[model samples]
Target: MLRIAVPFTTLLIFSNCGMPPAECEPNSRRCEGDLLIGCDDTGHEAVTDCTALGATCVPQLTRCIVATPMLQPDAGQTIDAGEATDAGAEDAGAPLEDAGLPDAGPAVIDAGTPDAGLVCTGAFPTNTTAPAMPPYAGTAYIDADAMQATDPSSFVDLTYAGRGVRTMFDRRTNSYNQVNALLFDARFGISKHVEIQVNPEFTQAVAEQHARFYAHAVGQLPAFLFRDLDTMWIHDGNDLFGGANRNILIHVQQGRYLAMYGWLEEVLLHEATHTSLDSYHLNMPRWQQAATADRVAISDYARDNPMREDVSETVPVWFFSRFRAQRLDASMLTTIENTVPNRLRYLDCLGFDDAILP
Candidate 1:
């Protein structure tokens, strides 16, 4: 009865692509008929909160950016990013179904690199949309032309490949502001397959330091594709490296969610490390092997309910924090030791220099 996610406690159904159930947000069944906002050209009231949050806080003025390329938004309905919310409102609709193909498992990428390489530099698209994105989100297409035009071998760069994820999940995961936006940006740069090849010698060194810190829990992170990291820096509208933007995904927390910044970074690194090492199992798709390898990586908070979720955020944060210019805290280190086991050595068997910094 929540968003398309259905909140099965652990499982998320993705088989159906039909319109989502218009009842309540996932994990909650409170009524919201009065909190709805926005309207279509045909005079039909539009729901600003498809996930049944509070209400649209901004004015819903429908405006299209990029004007649309392929598979345009519906003529009557506004752009997915156009809707805003108020405090209390709910427009009734049908029961929502699953969002995307559900378990596509990150292997749908077909286009390899083009003839001329280096064209991929400055090529990874910073802003774009997928074709089948929900009516509530932004355009979901990944600009492949920009990719081929820049670095052809950027194929290993899962940033664009993972672009489809935005269209898959129905709700936000805390990307409503700056810090959280950076978190999403950071995750977007890597993949669930492999996350160790983080270039920029300093970053890699930081990762190694974290790896050593959590050596007991076995932070066996996978190596990234190549030495040349095809990185996409999400530049907030501030100075070259500061400020924030709207490209961040909005994630809604359920209960007892860990929102600490340091832990979140460890999760990003660890999960991104999973994305990097994930490529090793190309022989078996959907990452059954990769997911199974966590026995070594799983520990501490990782052993908690859906500890995988916590590990995905906490491991990287703890790892990265250890190497921060500021002295890393001993409590955070213990948090890693107790909650997560070190698993970086497993990648060493894959011919990855997990011990060495990028």
Candidate 2:
């Protein structure tokens, strides 16, 4: 039996030395006695058997290589096995940290500019001229002839005509005409300007025309008391006129002309006394104080509202005895002087005694 014995140490040395080198310097490779020894291209540094990994060595690359192809190298350049070529290298001047990656910072954004247009140059204009005068002058253009030709009294008579009961003294078309005439008579009978100043507009309507004269007399009373009489219907059943703040209305049951006129004229001065004093401060608190100081009233009406009617009622009696020489049955002046002496004193303070008598 011609058997050959091999040492285990020598067999181990042969096994390792026959393996290829995975990595090599440029243009270098491992070699054995009649064969080339190379490594597989596994991107690692290992001594691998080329035959076992099915790879070969390339002297031009100087590496143990595989049959798998790589990217072509640049002209006149060589690369080592298991080493990256310029084919997959970063750009020459690019940052190595950002290789094969997107930019890791904020992007730049652009915004454009603005434009402005037209400007004003000229100065604003203003008015330097004066305004013109008004065209129509007041009252100067009014025609006096046209005004006088139109009678104002006739117009007033026409307004109240046929409004109420017609009296014996009233005309067919003018209801207050007779009353207006009596007012004019009473006006002139007292003084020329008395009607114009005291009661300029006295025409009014009544239940009958014969009552017109009496209505004119009642119109001569104070505006305030007259208002009270009208609101209270003081003369509703009598033939006397109902009083208003501005006018009067007479209640007439009988149609006697001259007789009614006589009675109205008799009372005209009495009511006129009230109208005259009323032109002063008859409605003031001072008048009330004077009436209170009197302490007694002259008539039933004065007794009822001494503060309101005392002065009107007392003044008339004083006037009749002092100026008209008419005898009153009530002897009201003597009664006022005896019972309420301050009443006489108040009338004297108002200069009524001198004013009526003188």
Q: Estimate each model's TM-score.
A: 0.24, 0.32
Tens digits of per-residue lDDT, candidate 1, 193-266, equal 22222112134334343222222111222233222222222211111110011111111121101111012222
Clashes of 2: 2
Give me the runs in candidate 1 sitting further than 4 Å from their true place.
1-168, 172-275, 278-301, 305-318, 321-326, 334-344, 347-358
Candidate No. with top lDDT: 2
| Whole-model alpha-carbon lDDT for candidate 1 | 0.23
Name the runs in model 2 displaced over 4 angstroms. 1-239, 243-248, 254-270, 273-276, 279-281, 324-333, 352-358
Candidate 1 displacement at residue 155 in angstroms? 17
Could you tell me which 10 consecutive residues in candidate 1 have the lowest summed lDDT?
Answer: 1-10
